[model samples]
Structure formats: structure tokens, C-alpha cells
Target: MRFYQATRFLFPGSLRLRMLALCSVGTHIPLLALAGWQLATGRADWPSLGLVIGATLVGTLFTLLCIDALLAPVRIATRAVAALEREQTAALTAVRDGDLLAELVVGVNRATEATKVRIATLDDAAHRDPLTGLLNRRGFLTRTEAARDGTVALIDLDRFKAVNDQFGHDAGDAILQDFAAYLARGVRRSDCVARWGGEEFAVFFPETEEGEAAGILHRIVRRMGAGLIDRPDGSPVTCSGGVVALDGETIGQAMTRADAALYAAKRAGRNQLRVSDAHIRLD
Candidate 1:
């Protein structure tokens, strides 16, 4: 048995076939040897030897077939478990009234469903903003770790504090929610936007050139200006942003440059976009 286990890799077939081969070799070889001894000692006739050999073959084949049938449910359970590992949402199909193995399948299916729900809830909590339903900073970093040749921007709402002070925190919350929705709707499906913290946000335009990113950001801001939660004066809500091509820089370095450019935008005039050079203008 140990030798068989050690060399299992050399035997290439389904588990059922391998098990059947081992069982046949273990049981049939001794019985055939005993029959040969009996015949040599004149205790059994050749015709009786033939009958014994035939009966042994028939009995082994039938028993092995039943065993293979019994293993089918175990195989199904194994495959279902593997699928769950590969895909978080995977589940097992329902099994009707059955024996102990069938009950096991049903139990596994129920367990899989429970695990799926728990995982979904945990994932959302880990990666999502509770109030705005946007991806949080950690999520943004995790999802875009392998990104290349894209543009990243740091954006700030101009006069966000003034809005909070004048309208009360509830109204301020409304504005934030409105802003998050606007960002979600305005960006292309391929772009990722995150609520970096407070009134600051981050955006990534993957595989985008600096010029193209500039245009997309401007458009998004322009639309956001008119659509956000209303101010009593009805002046459009505006934002200042700084965008930088990822180029060869780490995201942290690019964000540093972008932050500098953001402050530059805030200093120059509240509502505009700036580029990485700190000296370059994106008017």
C-alpha cells in the first residue's frame, strides 16, 4: 500500500480506476494461488477449478461496479467544493431524498451558501464607503496595484468646508452623496474612482494619455458643477483637480506631485485642472 501511494503519480487514471485495480490485485491473486495449490494436491478437479475462477471474476466485477456507483456522490461533492474555492459565488445543485451521502451533499450546499453570504458582506465592508457606496482608498490601491501607463488625479471640492458650515452636517452629507453619485455616473466603465478621504477623491484613467485624461476630467467636473446638491446662491458647485501621467513613477510619488498641483489649482483659482510639472498649466 505504501509503495502504491508513493508511486501514485506514475498511475494515470481516475481515482475510481486506481482503487479498482488495487482491490483486484489484492484479493484475486491469493484466491487464484490457493486454487492452483488445491489442484496440484488433487483436492479439486480441473472443471471445479474452472468454476471457481469464473465465479471469482464475476463476483469481483459486480462488487467493483457497485462501489463505483456509490462513489459518484462523493465525486460530485468534491467537484462542488472545488468550484466554491475557485469562485466565491459558486454553489451546489439541490439533491432530492437520498441516503447518507445525499444528505451530506445537501449539507455542503447549505454551508457553501452561508459562506458565500459572509464573504460578500466582509468584502463590502473591507472595500466600500458606508455612506457614499464608493470604493475606499484601500480598495483603490488593491485593485489598481498592477496598473501601467495610466493617469491619476487627486480632486478636491472647492469651498467644501463653507458648505458644511452653512448648511449643517446633514446637508453636507447630502452634497457628498450627490458628488459620489455624479463621479460614478460620469466616468467611463474602465475608470476607477475612490473616496480618498473627507472631501478629497481619487480617479484613475487606465491606458489613458495625459491629454486624454485632462479632457475626461474636465468634462466630468463640468457636469458635476451643474448637478450637485443646490447652494442657496445657485452658483454651480465646482472642484479643483490635479492630474499626472503614471509614466514610470510609483503611485505614491505621482500622488505627491498631483497633491502639489491640486494646491496650485486652489491657489491660482478654485475651479480648474493642473498637471504634474507644478509649473505646467492645463487651461
Candidate 2:
């Protein structure tokens, strides 16, 4: 293997080939001169000259053939790499002559498979919320096209700041997690939930009417808010939510309306569900 790899410099298609050709001529020239001198002195026969020429031609042909065989795998590898760049995986079948190159091709295929799996796993992790184990903003939007003709609800925890300030951020995180679990329990399998950042969560009800979506969000707000969070002091925590209807607008715009309704709910009084309507204010 080491010899084959090292002799890559001896192959054609390189500046080294011209240098090698020059060296071959230089070495063979002196030998031919000596042979001619022996022939002139009547010490060498014509048959011996023929034998030398034949030997040189056979040796050169064999060397060039071996080098060409070695480069075949490299060419195959180059094409395989191009395929891998275009797609995620490509297999090299050109090196199937039961040689070391075949082993290398098999290894490369296995490595490419592993790389593809690892990339897919990373993509999934990147789109998922680490804390709530729900879809993050990017993931939600990626799947939003399939979720059309649906209503999206923005669920913001009412007085979430009080929880963070009073019970500590850790406790606030725990409260949000608990709320997320409760909300999950309230939603159907057709619905998708996403952590839209901070204490705000968005829910998508696919192919659902506005009234049906409102009832579902109402349940989520009531059940999730009524659920208690056990603090370090062994006390309970509560939350509220704002719901909004969604239509042809982008998810961000729909979320803004929901957030506005959430703020309005907080302003009206904590622990209540406020649904956004055209008559409502930003409060």
C-alpha cells in the first residue's frame, strides 16, 4: 500500500512525468552508447541488441499499465466525491477488483452514511426547543405550510414576570415547564405546539375552525393556568393566557395579535383568558 501510494508521483498527467521521461532517456542513452561501443568492437551480437530492446519495451509498457491501473481508483474517488457534494451520500463501485482500493471505497461509504445520520440528528435538535421539548420558531415555520387553514393561538403566561421575580428564574422555568405539560395534555394529536420564546407559546390547530380553535385554546388557558407549580416554599403558582384567531397572515403577525390579547388579559386582571377581536386595543 505504501509503495503504491508513494509511486503516485511516477504517474502521468503531472510535471513529474516530463522529468521522468527526461531521466528515462538520460539513463537509457548511456546504456545504448555502451552497447553500441561493444557492437563496434565486435564484442556484442545483433541478437543481444534485440533482446535489450525487447526487454526495455516490455518493462516500460508494464510500468505504464500499473500506473494507469492505480489512477483508475483515484478517478473513481473524484467522481464519488462530486456525487456526495451534490447529494448526501454516494458509493464507489469502480474499485471492485478485490484490492486495497476496494476496502477504502467501502470505508468511505460507511463514513458517508454515518455523516448523513449525524447531520440529520443535529438538524432535528436544532429545530426543537431544549426546555419544553416542543418545536422552536424555525421548526414551526418549516412545518407551517402543512398546517394551513388552521387557527394559531398565542399563549402568554399572565404575570409570568412576578413568578420569575418572586420565586426566582429557576422556579419560573419550572412553572413554564409545568404549564407546557398541562397545555400538551389539553391539545389533540392534530395540534402542534411551539415555544415562541420566553413565557409565550403558540399552538396550531390544523384544519380547525375559529370557534373550535377558540374552545381548544380556552381549555389550554384554563387547564394550564389552573394547574399549580410547587415552589421551593411549597406554595402554588398560577398563569393566564391570551388567544387570537389566525388567517392569511404570517405566523409572526398572528402571534403579535395573540400577544396583544395576552397583554390585554393581564391588564384587565390576571388569571383570565382574553381573546383578541378587531374591537380590542393593543393593551
Candidate 3:
């Protein structure tokens, strides 16, 4: 490494230059010794010495050309690491086996896989609400960006501030976790639920009609009213929701209507669901 660093001034990113330098020094040292010995024994000849020098130069050039092929594994690993550092890609595998540097390649392959998993874990954490173990708003939006054809809802726990004020934030946090779990259980694996900040949550049902989505939300509301989880005030935990369809709109576009409908449910009394009138109706 030190040798490469020094030689890099003359030939940037050329490890072969260093290798050729070493090879020339190694090959010529013996030649120097032989030449000195022959001269001391009165056997020195210019023709023979020139021939030896020509052969050494040709051999060194050939060796340098051949060695680059043998360094394929190193190049592969280098590129993989570079890509990973930039967070451009993931899920790497060994390019091949049975190379001279197969062990290096295999090690790099394992390292890349491990790195990808760690990166995924960190990304998940960044997008999650730690208290509820559900996707946070950012995660929700990221995951549903491509899922434009779906049904979605925005839900807010009714009078949740009363619980936080009366029982303290710890108890409030517990209620939120319970609410998140209940929502998760109510939805299918293909569905998504996220904590949309404070006591609000978001749900997405991909490729679903508003009617089916409404039915699902209604059942959840019914169960929640039955005290699936109670508030710190010993009253039934209830919520209000606004369901909207994404027939030809993005999640962001639907969120406006869903939020409006959610507020409408909150106004008309909580523990109910509403939809955009003259729009997709789950009623």
C-alpha cells in the first residue's frame, strides 16, 4: 500500500506500475550479480548483456498484462463496495467461484449481504414510530407512493388528549400501541398501517374498493367501541376516520379528502367513518 501511494504520483490508480517496478528490480538484481561475476572472470560480453536486458523487459511487460486478468475478483469487490457506499443498490452475490482470489470474492459477497441487511434495518427504523412499532408518516408515504390505485383512510383517536392529560403520556403511549396493534390485526398483509403523528394513524388497502375498505373500517370501529382497549378515563377507546379512494389519484391527493372527511366524522360525533360525497362511497 505504501509503495502504491508513492508510485501513484507517477501513475495514478495503476497498481500494475508498482508491480512492474518490483518485478523489474527483482529480475534485474540477479542479472546485475551475474554480470559483475562474469566481468570479474574476464567473460563479460555486450551482446549477451543486451540480450538479457531485452528478455527481462519483454517478460515484465507480458507479466503485467497477464496479472490484470487475475485481479478480476478485486475489481468486482471494489465496485460492489463503491455502490453500497453510495446507497445505490443491494443484494449482492459472488461474481463467480474457482478464481485464484476466490476467498477474497467470497468474503466480499458475505460482507455485502450483511451490509445490505443492516442498511435495510436502519431504513426501517427511520420510517417507523418506535412507540407503536408501526410505520411513521414518512414510511407510509414512501411505501404507498407507487400504490396509487387503492383505498386509504386517516384515523384519529377521539378525545385522546383527555387521556394524555389525565393519565400521563406513558399510559397514552400504551393506548397508542394497543390501537396500532388492533389496526394491524384488522388489515390484511397486503394492507398498510402507519402512525401519522400524535394520535392519528393512516391505513392503506392496495387495489381495494372504497366499499370493502369501509366495511373493514366499520368492523374495526365497532370492535374498538366494544372496549378492545380502554382509555385511562375507563371509557371505551373510540376513533374517527375518513375513507377515500385512489382510483386515479396519488396518496397525497387523497389525503386532503380523507383528512376533511376525518374531521367531518369528528364533528358529527366520533367512532364513525365518512367518505367524500359524490365520490367513492363506502356507505
Please, what are the lDDT tens digits per residue for candidate 2 over residues 1-283?
5754454444323523643465567546856996889878988877878887777766666666666677776768755754555454445554433343444555567667867888999999988888988888888777784444667777777667777888699888887788788777778988888888888787887777766777766665555445455556664454555666666777667777777767777777766666656414222
lDDT of 3: 0.80
TM-score for each of the candidates: 0.64, 0.64, 0.64
Q: Evaluate residue 231 in candidate 1 and report its C-alpha lDDT on the 0 to 100 scale.
A: 60
Off by over 4 Å in 3: 1-107, 278-283
lDDT of 1: 0.76
Task: Give the best candidate by lDDT.
Answer: 3
So what's the TM-score on candidate 1?
0.64
After TM-score superposition, the amount by which residue 93's alpha carbon in candidate 2 deviates from its true location, in angstroms, is 14
Of 2 and 3, the candidate ranking higher by lDDT: 3
Instruction: Supply the TM-score for candidate 2.
Output: 0.64
- All-Cα superposition RMSD per candidate: 8.5, 9.5, 9.4
Q: lDDT by residue for model 1 over 188-233, one digit each (tens)?
A: 8999989988999888888988778888878867766665556645
The lDDT for every candidate, in the order shown, is 0.76, 0.67, 0.80
